[model samples]
Target: MLRALRSVRSGLHATYLESYFISQCDKLSSKWLTRGLHSAPAEDVAEDAGVTAAVGARSGERPNKSNRNQEVRPFTSIPGPKPLPLLGNKLFFTTIGGYPMERYWESVQRIYEKYGPVVKVERFSGSLDMVIAFRPEDTRKMFQAEGIYPMRPGLGILTHYRSKRPQWFSSPGLVPGNGPEWRRLRSVIHPLLRREVINAYRPAQTEVANDLVRAIAASNQHNTKQDPSRHIISDTLSILFHYTLEAVGVVSLGMRLGCLASTSANCQAQSIIKANIEVLNVLGESMLQPPLYKLFPTRGYRRLSAAQDTICRQVDVEVARRREELALDPEGFTQRHPFLASLMNNPDLSSQDVFLLLIETLQGGIDATATTLGFCLYFLAGHPAVQDKLLKEVQHVQPEIHTLQGLPYLRAVVQETLRLRPSAAARSRVIQEDTIISGYCVPAGTFVVSPPNVACYDPQIFPGA
Candidate 1:
């Protein structure tokens, strides 16, 4: 059954790819012909016209040394959707439901296809101007030129919440801040999330995975006769959410919430999972829409506030419990969970700071890990051959708690999934200085977005995509 499904999907994908290429060829032909370069191929025309020059243009690359000091041109001259009197592309983004942040990749792709790679998009009545770059070369340049302290734009609602509760959160954690404060927090916790450190927690992670398998089996006991491909549990995302939250909780808080247990349905563990989902949903909406919460206490804003309080309160309780245990026997506490103990021991970070940090870490891990795992399962379910191969590899290794090495096929599956459907579809960076991207002058203070989805689909990079 799965094999049949795979065949159908492959046929559909091929059809789509063929049509896409044909459309692209038409676009290129028209563009080149308009320039009176119809005699040569589009690639040749692009090469002769120095289309790649914009990619490599930078301050130090100038041949004329005397011309390097001149002020660069502004980014306003870039072509984009024309702005109206008050609404700047906001109305275009609006639908019957709301702003489409959930489907942001689709929106970005529409803009990229319509206005070309380096198109400008204005939001919030032109208060926010963003330059969207789809080409891989432009993305490379943007990251390379990002200064010592690379600033990632985050949800504004989170910043507002943190500010309201100043006593609890002294500064925004890694997600919502830049400059010295971000650097300081990142420096303190960076080592804890390093590759080696995370690898050490593999034993705990495997235990959680095992628990998840049991939970799924128990939940689907009544539907055992159903075809594996058509099983209801296969389509449900809640199981993945629970599994990821439990796994991340164990790693972050040095304890399990039993989120995978059958009896955890109405418990505090379940409540925490629900709160995390709500926070993400509310924050995503708040980020795309107007900040009406500041002017009036809106329902979304209120819900976000409640979710934040729930998370912070729970984290505080856990931190207090750990502190009490550490005071009782510091040596034993350090032996059990040295990673978390080390963070608690840091002199610079207060209790509230540690709580806020844990909240950010857990929230970040839950959504990304869950989404990735969900995609992996979806892909593997459709490709039983690959699944069988992976199973054989796993069986051969008889992978122990912390021993996931020598799993090349498993690693490839993950890498390929990320390449195809990355958790972070688009990344934004605040440009600190004037820079040339694809021949366009993108000035400082402009928000620049690089869509990995666009680059990932490039035939040149990933042939046969």
Candidate 2:
């Protein structure tokens, strides 16, 4: 019965392919008509099976007529790993933990070593297109492909409630989708992330950093100064979270989280942000297990929702307060460092758009900066010599992180860290159109990804791996 079904399907596919090919010929004919060109012979058309297959695939049709003498050519199917029924390859992926990508990295390399550079894997209902580029050149090809060989949809764990918070940092199009909005936001923020803009934040950052240091010192003072050895490793993430809130506070709303003082005070706002971020961590982790996430109604989700609501309400209040303050002194908008204020003053952007942008920036800034800085520390810790080199470089300018700006080695350290342990490591996008990679002709509308684990570790780029 299965054989019969296959046969019937094959026949249908062949018919579809023939119709698709005829349509392509029509298109070609239309183009040539303007030049007064005659139609090519039938044999000429028949010889172009690759072109026919491509056209058919584009039109959502298939050619199942004959496997014989046909150019399997590049990739008839996007290759991947095979999986067991129902469960797929979930078990295999889950068994290897602590940096999901690392395990996948190892598996991908092993598969490529055994088979070739590109292989296929079955991931639940999805088919994963895996590639192990052993050289920097191959890595460049993948990155250069960008929109073509883009990051995959983040694991389900990271996407929970992503849509719920339109005000979410991810809302600025940073969450993952490939679209005009994403492009727009990226353009606006990239310049701000440049060394000059980052340096602009140094005054504020140093204030915050000093506050953190002071807090630690005070804790030790309270403890009778008996060898206070808790390393002042700025939870780059937490600090970033604080810094972002404060930055947006001053720039957007003419307010400040007063996080420096708040950290010591453990105020309501500080607690709320911490709670929400923690909830994010929990939810993000939970997204890994589909069944478990589905079966259980965790307290973390409730806490997260509550935290978000609280934060949003607080933001609304802050906005209202700023409006009243601006009413008293109209020049405040121009005078203040608030980014949102400048944007608000702009005649172009709507108030709603400005508000949404502020929220996205604040939230995204909080987490992303910290995650990046944390990852940098992670690499630095692993490579003590690298850390030592960095420390020596910083010694000449100790306590002046801004001086490290544009320093080649410092920049390399940061870039290398991002390459190795990206904060938002994996990403996903729907294939916009039919595309080819490593000889695989993938159909449009399919979800595709370039896992950083694989991209960063590509032997061609990093070599030693």
RMSD of 2: 16.9
lDDT of 1 by residue, 300-341 (tens): 989989988887788778878888998999999877776778
The lDDT of each candidate is: 0.63, 0.46
Clashing residue pairs in candidate 1 (N, C-alpha, C atoms within 3 angstroms): 54-439
Off by over 4 Å in 1: 1-74, 96-99, 123-125, 221-231, 263-266, 398-405
The root-mean-square deviation over C-alpha atoms between each candidate and the true structure, in angstroms, is 9.7, 16.9
TM-score, each model?
Answer: 0.80, 0.62
Q: Candidate 2 versus the native: TM-score? A: 0.62
Ten-residue region with minimum lDDT total, candidate 1: 11-20
Among the numbered candidates, top lDDT falls to 1
**CA deviation > 4 Å runs, candidate 2:** 1-78, 83-200, 215-254, 262-264, 282-304, 378-385, 395-405, 463-465
